[model samples]
Target: MDGDCKTAVVTGGTGEIGFAIAHKLLCNKGKKVVLIGNDTKKGSEVVDSLNCSFGRSKATFYKCDITNREEVEGTMKKAKNDLDEIDIVVNAAGVWNDVCWPNEMETNLGGTINVVLSARNHIKKGNGVVINLTGLSALEPFPNSPLFASFGAGVIHFTRSFGHDVNFRRFGVRVVALCLGITKTNLHVDLDKKMLTKEMGKGMSDFLKNACYQKPDACACAVAELVKYGPPGSVWVVEGSRLFYYDVPDYKECLNLVSQFM
Candidate 1:
């Protein structure tokens, strides 16, 4: 977090896991943390608390809805002016519409794109890192979230392959995606309800019960560690257990884990 580490921009920092990561970066790593979210109440509260808990460790909050491209861009401008440069962008901001299917994609996918676009400009010469949070459903589809599954899948590929399309190496930016499994975040509640009424909803409910989720502090630890151990194209899965990479065993283990829910 210190000594030339990039400034950390955590989208959705007002939320559960995002808050955890922001605190970890500040309290543990001493990173310059700027938390971005739309909830002024919660956002300001978190900033105030951080000022108390971590003694202001360069942590601030900004009002932004990542789904708004213009707002995201503007926020980036302000952030750059405040921090000078952005070294890491964590796309922890996510959404799921309880009443509709496609809104899931609109909120999650659209928001991610806006964050990535804004964050990309500040990353330089293999220095900046983008860590994205994707749900287990990104790979393990639930019938209730058909469109969400499709959109998440697209994001997975996009994160892994976008480097090839862009000159990140020349620019010194590293973009990696974190495929998160079942975690007890605010998103989990809405996701559980959205899929629970579907044809396969019953099993998903049971799956939720059996799942293990640590405190948001634990998740923050994992991401911070990954940042210390990353380059372009790095991927990690932060589950109840230790962090794991994407590979054959990951798919198989997750497949077995998926069976219990299906």
Candidate 2:
């Protein structure tokens, strides 16, 4: 790798959206990447494919369960030591299984906290960026999967709080959230089975049938654009293959809106 080459660490890099982001970062942006995931076999296969496509040593994989704080710290340390420095960290690992709500919360919310806290110290300050991937349920209520939506909302709040301007000024790292719309990925497969109840599952399935779905590549493209220009503490929505900034109202704004009705 060149002395000036940027490097990234992407959790859940073996998954569709995550892998797409890593590929975009490497092929288009000329960045080396370390893929973090739990499946060692899948991780190795992804690393091998990326290295073959980009170049030898351009990609590496570290087996890690992001929910495990100690494991995450160790993995981040190893990734930093190997890369010399990490310029970007993308928290793309998440679960949507409401049937296993505890595990879902642990993987989605807890895992994000672990990864960001562990990796922030080694990230290249001043220019480093952290992209936390949530879903549209964060912004809009999902009647079918309230548990999953709650996790998304929690992630969005966490991202905004951590990525606030005051914190950015002190740490010099830009943190942003990307709320993706319905995308064709494994997360969507057998959605009815992952729901909390049969009625909710059927309703969700019906709702999705009429909703617009985009490819994972579109989400990847959005991530690339955000990585380059997204501001700290900002939230972006990527839906129907379009990317746009999402305005999350502050407490004062909400208060004013409520006062209008009174």
Quick one: best lDDT, which candidate? Answer: 2
What is candidate 2's CA lDDT for residue 210? 92
On residues 45-73, what C-alpha lDDT tens digit does candidate 1 reach at each position? 99988888867557899998787889999
Candidate 2 accuracy as TM-score: 0.94
Worst 10 residues of 2 by lDDT: 253-262
Alpha-carbon deviation at 199 in model 2, angstroms = 0.9
For all candidates in order, the CA lDDT equals 0.73, 0.89
lDDT of 2 by residue, 1-262 (tens): 1213689999999999999999988867555899999899999999999999998999999999898999999999999998898988999998889999999999999999998887678899999999999889998888999999999999999999999999899899989999999999988889888899999999888988898989999988888888888899899999999999998876786664435554
